[model samples]
Target: MSLNRRCSRTACGRPAVSTLTYVYADQTAVLGPLATFAEPHAYDLCEVHSERLSAPRGWDVLRLAPDPNAIGPTTDDLLALADAVREAARPVPVTVSAPSAETGREVARKGHLRMLTSE
Candidate 1:
C-alpha cells in the first residue's frame, strides 16, 4: 500500500517514492513509482529494489524478487494506492526557452558528452 509519510529509511529523507504492495499468500511484491498518475498495478520489487526507490539518483529500483516468497501484491486487497500515486506524480508545469545558438555551438565544440576531472 502507498505510505503517507516518507520512506522509513532514516538516512534517506526523501519521500516514499514508491509502493511495496504484497498480495496475501503471493510470492511477489508489486513495486511502483509513488508518482504514477494511473491506477496502481501489480509490479513487485525486491528488497534491494524497494530500498533504491527513494534513492537520490532519481533511478527506479522497482524489481521482481527471485523467490516467490519474497513479496507480491495479492489479488485480494485493493488499497487506495492509485490516489497516493496520483498525488505524488502531480506535475508542476514549467517553461524553458530554447538554448541560444552560442550555447549549443559551445557544447558541440566540447563534444556531445564531457566528463569533468577533479582539479
Candidate 2:
C-alpha cells in the first residue's frame, strides 16, 4: 500500500510533492520537497500548489532543492539484494544419522534450516 500524503489545499487530492512551512520570525515562506515524515505544523502540497506558491509581498520565499536520497532505491540496494539471494541459493551438504534408540527421536540441522525431533 502506498503511504503518499495528499495535498493540503482544499478540493485538491493530488499526492503531495513538496512541503510548505512559514518562518514567522523571518517573515519567510520555506518551500521544499516533501519531508520524509509529515510535520504537525507544516502543510504538504502537490506539484501545482508548490510551483504556484508565493509569499507575502514583502516576505521572502526560500525554495530548497529536492532531496536526492529520497528519490528511490539506489544500485547498492539491488546489489545487496542480489548477493543475499545468491548466498541463499548456494547449496550446502547435510549429514544425517539414524535416530538414537535411547531418545527415540530424529533431528537434523543445516545452515539456518532446522528439523524438529520426531518421535
Candidate 3:
C-alpha cells in the first residue's frame, strides 16, 4: 500500500520525501513532510530538491523540519509490536458466549484482548 511517488520537478526521478505548496495570497511556499495523499495544489519534492528549495523575490519559504524522535521505531515500540504478534498467535479457548433468555446478549466480546495501555 506504499505510495511510489517521484519528485515533481522535471527530469529529477528521485523519490519524494517532502511536499511543497504555495500560498498565493500570502506569497509563501510551504515545505512540509510528505503529504498522506497527493494534492492538486501541492508538489512532491525529494531530499535534494527540498534542501535547495527557494522562493521567489519578496516571497517567504517556510520549511517544516521532521521530528527527530519520529524518524524510526523505538525499542519499546518494537517490543510492543512483538508482544502483540505473540498474543495474536496464541490459541483460543473453546468457550463460546451466547445470548440466553435469562440474560441479554453478552455486553462485551470474549477472548479478544486489545492493548489499550502499557499496563
Model 2 worst lDDT window (10 residues): 97-106
Q: What is the C-alpha RMSD of each candidate to the true structure, in Å?
A: 18.7, 10.0, 10.2
Q: What's model 2's TM-score?
A: 0.55
Candidate 1 RMSD computed on C-alpha atoms after optimal superposition onto the true structure: 18.7
The digit string of per-residue lDDT tens for model 2 on 43-80 reads: 99998999999888899999998756655656998899
What do the candidate models score in CA lDDT, each in turn?
A: 0.45, 0.83, 0.82
- Point out the higher-scoring one by TM-score: 1 or 2: 2
Q: Candidate 3 lDDT, tens digit per residue, 27-75?
A: 9999998877899989999999999999999999999987666756679
Ranking by lDDT: 2, 3, 1
lDDT winner? 2
lDDT of prediction 2:
0.83
> Model 3 segments beyond 4 Å from truth?
71-119
**Which ten residues in a row are the worst by lDDT in model 3?**
110-119
